[model samples]
Target: MTKWLLPESLADILPAEARRIEELRRKLLDLYRVYGFELVMPPLVEYLESLLTGHGHDLSLRTNKLVDQLSGRTLGVRADMTPQVARIDAHLLNREGVTRLCYCGSVLHAKPMGLLSDRELLQIGAEIFGHAGVEADIQVIELALESVRLAGVEHARLDLNHPGVSRAIIEADPALARNAEDVADLLSTKDVTGLRAFASETPLQAGSLDALIALTQLYGGGEVLQRAREVLPQLPQVGQALADLEQLAGFLSDYEVSFDFADVRSGYGYHSGIVFAIYADGWHDTLVRGGRYDGVGTAFGRARPATGFSLDLRALAGGLAPAEPAKAVRAPWGCDPALSAALRALRAQGIIVVQVLPGQQQSLDEFVFDRELVCEQGQWKVRAIQ
Candidate 1:
């Protein structure tokens, strides 16, 4: 085995792709700044408890754990930055009003999420804390949609789900509530057969079983909301969840929006209300995922209303067209004052200048030397390459 060979599902980003990812990161961070989201960078690793608090088994399974040599305690590499940002809002900042924060960093997953996914991801996102209303949800969703739009993603589809719909039905039945996790797994997969089997094995009320079966078919365009009202039980919580989805859909009338009640569970169990995932044609899976995860900061001793969205920059860049190589001016290696001044001036003007070193072949993947800087009649000037 070669020492340079990376593990399965782990790969390095070459020059062109890396440049595109960096550019996307800069654009997104700047966009978030315009929306009053202050940037924060949490450490890549932290105590396992701090990293995993409030998030459920899914995040735990994704996080890579190690023992801290200095503190002799277990530590975890973060798989998600949301909880960390929440901690910052609750403990560090302790602000009274709504706090908007944004972050961009790499997160390590214990395993690849899909066949085409990389174990290492460049995660970028924005979060709003201390606001509970649907207004915050609308803001984050718009920001999320705008993110892909800015990246040149056309015809993106937004699939919305509220765990409360399923949660209400399950809570109404003791048997389903007791086995919520197993039930959620089945529903998320849309395994009607598996659901029937599980229901038969467990003691459940007829109404709850019927409702669970009804959820599997409640996925589609805006009409799904109407069908849900007719098919699902008329519980107050279910009514409220449907109303919330209707409100969100109405506000997002400008874009493609749909609903899927069977996607009842979030990747992390912390999401307390409306959950959403964005899908586009080229992408095999969701490009972005987020929603309201209110009270996520309670583990840090202060609970606050929060909503946000995050996407893997690497995954996003992979679907886009390759970036064009940057134009540059080639300069010969020299100690002459005139050559040095020309190089400095071009670079200061944001122009790429590739200085050829002695006995070295000038090769670059991210830049194309379209012009040359030369001394003509004792004056340094740039000329187009012929």
Candidate 2:
């Protein structure tokens, strides 16, 4: 075995890809800033209790645990940063009115979440706390769509599903309590054959049974919402969730919005409210998965209405090539004031200026240098390499 080799499903990010990831990070964070989202960088690790506060079971399972040497208490490498932000909002900031927070960092998972091998991921996201309105949900949804568009996936489709939709369905039929696991599996996968058998065994009326079965096929554009309202049983929970979905669709009217009613309990990390995922054209994996996770902050101190979205930066960066490498202006090493001033000036202009070391013989291939700073006729100037 190679001594320097990384563990399975883990590998080093090479220069080119690393540069792309960094560039995208800056661009997205800049956009988040523009949208009134203040960036907050949480630590890469935290105590297991604080990090896994509420609705973080999936997160807990994925987290890599270790014992803290000093405290002898178990610590965990975060598999998600959302809980940390929740703690910040609920306990640390403790501010009133809506709060907007954003974060970007690496998360480690015990198992692979791979596109190529996803033992680790660079997660970047934004969240809105203290607003419970569907309007807030719409804003974050639009923000998510714009984010992926800014990431260069302009044609991605935004698939919308409210975990509440499935919740409503279950609540409407209490008898389903016993068959909950089976129904959840069938609905989530849209397994028609299995659902038919399960629905027949239930004591639901022919009308209700038909509606339940129809939901599995009720996935498409705006019309699905209308059909859902007409076909699905009108339990109050189902009605309110449908209305929320309707409003969400209206706000996102310009984009290609989709509804998946059968994706019961659709969400991420114990998301109790609305949930959404983004799929780019020609990309098999989801580009983003996020939505409301209200009350997750209760475990900290305050339970505020909250919503947000997060995406893996590396996955998206892989699809789009990094910007053209910055052209480098190489300078010969010197103690002369003219050379130092010129180097400082170029750097100030956001130019890449590399100083060649004393007697360090190298080819252009050794480092990227397209132009050079030279002394021509005893005057310092920038010149192209011949």
Candidate 3:
């Protein structure tokens, strides 16, 4: 094999794509800053316990572990930045009021999240800590939508779900106790036949079992919320989850928002409350996914309410590549003071100025250089290269 051959799903990002991803990253961070979210950079690796704390078994499996050469202790590469952010909010900064923290970096997962995704992803998102209200979830969702829009992604549909609805039913009933995981899987995939067969022998209440099966079919807009009310028991936990989804749907009136009662993945793992995913045209998987996972900081000490979402910067860029880098103005190396001064001024004004080495033959395609700097009328000026 050639030395340049790389591992599967792990390839170098060439200059063209790298530039777009970097620009999108800057725009998103700027958006976060304007909304009062402070930036935090967690390390790429940490002890297995610290990295996996509070996050569920799924994330733990995704994490890659290695023994430290110095201490002989096992260290794990982070598969998600959320847990690290939670640690910072809980222990390091343990402040009084609400804390808005955002992060961007690469996390190494043992496997690709999906068929097209890479094992190494540039995850970027903002988290809200110390606020348990639906307002926190709403703020995060709005920002997630805005981030996608800014990246030039279109036709995105937001699917909202509350894991609590199905969870509340399972917790409230004792007969369906042992088969919770299996039943949850069935509902998550909306396998109506499997759900019916699984619930038939179980000693669950007839009405409740019906609602559970109905949940598999419950989807679409606000009407699903009303439909959930009719079939599912109005337990406090379940009712609260419904109300939160309803409030969020109303708040985000501008988007293509819809409810997904069968989205067990959103409700599963560490998410204690509402969960959501954004779907867009041409993407095989969810463009972005997040939810309310309160008490994520319990392992650190104080259990603060936290909510945020993250996306792969590379994936977003591939889906929304901006127009070709605007025709650049290339220059040849020279000792002339005026030529050097003009180059500096153009750069300071944010122009893409590519300078070439003296006596070196530079190809126009190399830098997409469509313009050139030359002496015209005894003055250094930029002109279109024919």
> Which stretches in model 2 have alpha-carbon errors above 4 Å?
114-117, 172-186, 193-213, 264-269, 358-367
Q: Please, what is the TM-score per model?
A: 0.97, 0.88, 0.91
Residue-wise C-alpha lDDT for candidate 1, range 150-254, written one tens digit per residue? 998999999999988998998899999888888888998889999899988998997888898899999999999999999999899999999999998898899
Clashes of 2: 0
- lDDT (Cα atoms) of all candidates against the true structure: 0.92, 0.81, 0.86
Off by over 4 Å in 3: 174-179, 193-209, 267-269, 321-323, 358-366
User: Which is better, 1 or 3, measured by lDDT?
Assistant: 1
Weakest 10 consecutive residues, lDDT, candidate 3? Answer: 358-367
- What local lDDT does model 3 show for residue 356? 85
Measured with C-alpha atoms, the lDDT of residue 71 in candidate 1 is 94
lDDT measured at residue 291 in model 2 versus the true structure, 0 to 100:
87
Better of 2 and 3 by lDDT: 3
RMSD over all Cα atoms, model 1: 1.3
Error of 1 at 184 (Å): 1.0
lDDT of 2 at 57: 45
Error of 2 at 272 (Å): 2.8
